[model samples]
Target: MKTAGRQTDAIVLGAGIVGVSIALHLQERGRRVLLVDRGEPGAETSHGNAGLIERASVVPYAFPRGLSTLAAFASNRSIAVRYRPATLLRMAPWLARYWWNSAPGRLDRLGQAILPLIERCLDEHRQWTKAAGTESLMRDEGWIELYRSRRGLQQAVKAAAELAAYRLAYDVLDEAALQAREPGLLAGIVAGAVHWRDPATVSDPGAVTRAYAALFTARGGELRHADAAGLQQDSTGWRLSAGGEDWRAPEAVVALGPWSNDLCEPLGYRFPLGFKRGYHMHYAAAADTAPRHPLCDVEAGFVLTPMARGIRLTTGIELAARDAPSDSWQLDQAERQPLAVPEGFSLRWLHRDGAAPGSASLLTDALATLDWPAGEGSLYLWAACEHAAFRQIRAAARQYLRPEIDA
Candidate 1:
C-alpha cells in the first residue's frame, strides 16, 4: 500500500456506530474523512448490542434508590448493571468515578446533554437506513421495561417522572394489557410496564452496519480497508499513518469505542470509555414464542430480543477490554432466565464475540482522571431520577472553558 498524497480533512478511528456516524456527519459537513478500524465494521460491541436507539434512556445513568441495591443485592437485579466480579475487584479504584456519576444529579446532567443528540441521531439512522433500503430489517417497535413486583412498579413511577421531564413518551401497562400485547407471557408475571415508543431496534444489527457503510460509499466517501496505527500532529494539521500509507487530516475525531483510550493515550489525552463487556446468548428457537417488542427484565438483568434470525437473550456487563476472554460463568448465568422463555430456548454455548473475562480490559485509570467516582453507587444510581449532578458539572465546564470555534 502506498500513501495517498492528498491531505485528509479528518481521520476517524474506529468503525463502530458512533465512529461511523461521526465520519458521515463530518463528510456531510464537507470535510474529507478517513475511518480506520482493526476489525470489519460493526464487529465489536456495537454489532452485538440489543440494537436499541433508546430515546427515553435520557434518564440519568444512576438509579435513585441505589443504596438499597447494595443491601438487597439479590432483590436488585437491575442495579447490577456492570458485572465481571473478578475483573471489577481488580479495577475497583478505577471504577469509582462511575459509581459517583450514578448519583442522581450526575446522571440527570448526562441525560440532558445526550438527549438533544439521541432523537436526532435516531432519525438520521432511520433515514440513512431507508435510503440504503434496509427498512424491513429495521423495526420501529418499542422497548418494554417490565415489572413483576410491586417494588418494580414503584421504580417505573420514578422512571415515568424522569421520562416526562425529558419529554419522552411512555405508557404504563397492567397485566391484562401486557398479556394482550404479548400473549405468550407467563401468567401472573406482570405487575406493570413502561413502554418507550421512541426506541427503534433492528432485527440484524450487522446488516444495519453494513448498510451504513454502503450508504457512505454510495455518497462518494472513500472506504479504506486498513489498520490505523498512530497519529502525528504537524503545522498543516494531523498526519495519520496506516496500511503503509500516510494521510493528513485538518480535523480528526476518535470514536474507536473500547479502543479509543489506547489509541489516544500516546497523544496525551485519554477518553473516558470503559469497556463494559456485555454478554448475549442466541438460541435456536424451539417454539414460535417470539416477542414483538424487546423485553427488559428488571430483575433478571438481561433482555430477550426475538429477531428474525433467532432469539437472543443478552445481559450482564463485565468491565474488561475488547480482547478479554468471556467469563464462562457470566455466559452460563444468562441461561438462567428470570422468566420462562418459550420451550426449547437455550443459551448459545459460546459468546458470539471472542470476549471473556480478562481477555481485554478498559483503561479504568481514565475514569479517575475524568473525576468519576469509584464504587457501586457510581455504577448504579439510587437517587431520584433527576441527574442534577451531571448538569452542574457541565455548567461548571461551560463557566470556565471557552466555546469551541467552528472548524
Candidate 2:
C-alpha cells in the first residue's frame, strides 16, 4: 500500500452519525482527526430510521415475557416482530444474553446507567444542528403512542409513571381527546394516547447526519473514502489505507455500528453485539390531510410520521443475520391499514407523488404534529438509543486522549 507518511492525533472508522459525532467532538477539542468510511456518511443503517432524537427514551427494549406476546412472535402472527429460524438458531446465545439482561432488575439498571446520556441527546444534537446549519430540520412536537384497548392504555399509563419518575413529561389523552388532536386519525379507533413532550423530531434523518459531517469537514477535519477493514497497528500507533494512500494516527476509534465486529473480531475483542433489522416506506397523504405528529399504532406494531417527502411508515424489528436478504412481508402486512392517513389514502397517492408504490426511502423523516391539546408517538424503534453506547465511547476516547485531564 502507498504510504502518505503523515500522522494525525486520531482516526475514526465509519461515517455514520456516531463516527461523525465523535470526530466532530475530537476536532473541537483540538485533535487532528481523520474520518474514514467506505461510502457516503449515514448512507447505511443510520440513514433509515424513524428520526426522533428521543430524550424520553429512558428504557431499552426488553425481550417479550408474556406468553401471548411470545406466541404471536413465534407463530409469525405479530407484525411488530419477525424472525428467520436459521437466524434465530445462530443468534440463540446472544438472544439468551439479551433476555437475561432484560430481566426487570437488569433492565432497570441499564436504564439508569444510560439515562444521563439520553437526557443529553437534545442538547448535544442541538449543538451539532446549529453548527451544521440544519436547525430547521428539528421539531419539538414530540410523539404519540395510541392504544386500541383499555388494557393496553392502562399498561401504557402504568409505564408512563415509571418514565415520569425520570422527569420525562407525558400527557394521557382519552379517545375523544386523541381524535380532537389528530382529526385525520380514524375516530374512536384508539382507546387512548400518550403524548411524550420531552423529545424532538427531525424532518430528514440522513440529511442531519450529512450536515454534521459537513461541519466536521468545515472544522478542518478530514473525511476520506476508505474501508475500515484494512486498519493496521504499528509501533507508532495505528494506520489505515484510504483514498489510495496509507495514513497514520496515534489513536483509532471503531464506530462502525452494525459492522463494528468486522474489525474488532480480528483484533481479538468480542462483544455480544446484535441488531434488529427494520423497513420503512413513504406515501403521499390525500389532499389537505396529513398526520400532525408521529403516531405509533401500538397494536399494529408500526409507526406513521409526517415527512417532507411524504408520510413515512416504519415497521418493527425483524430478527435476522446481518447479511440476510431483505424481506417485505412485514411491510406488506402493515400496508393493510396505513394509519395517520385519510380514509382514501392508498398506493395511488404514493405513485402520484413521484415515489413508486412500495418504494422504500433509504432514510426516514422523524415526527409530525397533531391538532389536539397534546399528541405524540412512541419513542421505541428510533435510532437515538444507540447514543447511549456512543456516550461511553466518547468518554473512553476523551480519557485516552487527555490523560492529564481529570475525569
Q: Identify the leading candidate in terms of TM-score.
A: 2
Backbone clashes counted, model 1: 44
Per-residue lDDT tens digits for candidate 1, residues 146-239, read 8878788887778588555567777788888888777767767668777877777777776777777677777877666666546666666667
Off by over 4 Å in 1: 1-4, 63-65, 72-86, 347-407
Model 1 misses residue 104 by how many Å? Answer: 2.7
Tens digit of lDDT per residue, candidate 2, span 165-260?
Answer: 687888999988887778877765678899998877777777988988998999898999998889876667777887776788767776776676
Instruction: State, as a TM-score between 0 and 1, how close model 2 is to the true structure.
Output: 0.86
Location of the lowest summed lDDT over 10 successive residues in candidate 2: 361-370
Over 4 Å off, model 2: 1-4, 338-340, 349-407
Give the Å shift of residue 374 in candidate 2: 51
Superposed Cα deviation of residue 30, candidate 2 (Å): 1.1
